[model samples]
Target: MTDLDYFDQFDDEGTEDSASKRDSLPDWVSNSNSSLAAYQAIQSLYKEKMQYIRGHSKKSHYTKKGSYHISKSEVARAAGLAKPNAIFHSVDYASKLTKELNDKNALLVASKEKILLSRSSSIKDLSKKELQSELRGRDRYKEISELKADEIVDLTLKRLPLDVKRQLYLA
Candidate 1:
């Protein structure tokens, strides 16, 4: 066959596949003929990408990458749009999505900081005598159990508060 005919055959198959995909889309996406519909389509694709990145989805279409970040062009391409800007044509929708993503990242960072702070603060909050006893206890446990230094530290931290409470009750 001529090159033109060969390519035409693939094009016809692609059209049929795309037509089937279009039929499977949501009723609103298939029925509407507006820019809003395009935006909605891109939004849904974006959520799917996020879900895949977060390991919440097992869809083969979204390949896992080293970086979790998703871009505007990726969403646009997934929605079969020619231009990424077309997806973000609605300023309100674009800004709202951006704000939501930022807020989620901010909350994640805040919670991580809180956990680190609590861990360090627990060690620092102990009095000098308590701190000394904690270290001595860790060493004793290490020697007795032949455990690694890191494991001993973890064990001591887990037991510290309870030990303090017992000492308080005794005194």
Candidate 2:
């Protein structure tokens, strides 16, 4: 059969007496008669073309030829977005974001632990000079970490809801 004749089969089986078919159809399908058979015919026309998303590419990362992994952040950067790891498209992008966030959180925890560890003695027992030295060390680390934290905040701001990020910023 000719390609043009292909649609004739689905159309004919669907029925000719449009009014009679309306009586047999369900309420939703019957109501669509206001648009004639256009919607139904189109749906039937592309039945084979419509496909469920089975899966995305399994590749762990996309690295341009001879280059390091092009992270989601990098992709967004290339696309001229303001932050990294902010866009979500597939499972891999979600995985990349999870790893980056978890890694940074662990660094923050480690820095806080270092400060706690530096205070070997109780504050009530330390000499004034020794206390100053310890405080200086903690402040140095805190300053460096605050820079990183700000970077993380910028990244998170691009991805998170504004109100949620506002609370984090205030805290």
Candidate 3:
């Protein structure tokens, strides 16, 4: 569909519900008989929607379950797809993403530890403002935290940029 046609699908009067604004399934997804494809499509749609909402509102789409978190299953239900089993291939993909995220956080933690350890004696001589200024800026911190760790590693290794390698402390 054309851009104008796609935009016209939304109600401008603020009378329609948000669900009405979401685009309908394309022909391939709508006509597919494969449950796996349908499930994947649903997951893709949820990922896109979550990204959009979080980008605008600075909010997460996760629902906390004790120490764990999960997304709502309404996206799958709306797409008429059965939720995949927890042990399915998609679970592995999710686990990998989570692991990468954790690894990235761990790297940041290690970086902080290294800085603190190296500056232990001199840190007391530095003021809070000086220390803050020495660290990565707020925007850069947010950008790095929001990035997918695997993607960051992939780009760094693929491009082999000297500055990036130095910043990441890659040998």
The local distance difference test score of each candidate is 0.54, 0.45, 0.47
How many clashing residue pairs appear in each of the predictions shown? Answer: 0, 1, 0
Task: Write candidate 2's Cα lDDT for 1-171 as tens digits.
Answer: 998888765756645686776676434333422222322332332232121111211122212311222234433444455554343333333444445434443543444445434643677757688789999999987876778767877765688877886887943
Off by over 4 Å in 2: 1-85, 88-91, 120-171
Q: Which stretches of candidate 3 lie over 4 Å from their true place?
A: 1-92, 120-171
**What is the descending lDDT order?**
1, 3, 2
Question: Where does candidate 2 have its weakest 10-residue lDDT segment?
Answer: 49-58
- Per-residue lDDT tens digits for candidate 3, residues 1-171, read 999999899867777564553344332332234434434444555455444333332112222221122232443444454663432235434444334334443543444344444543365656677678766577677887888989788765978878867887985
What shift in Å separates residue 42 of candidate 3 from its native position after superposition?
22
Residue 46 C-alpha lDDT in model 2 = 28
lDDT of 1 by residue, 4-25 (tens): 9887766564456766866765
- Worst lDDT window (10 residues) for model 3? 58-67
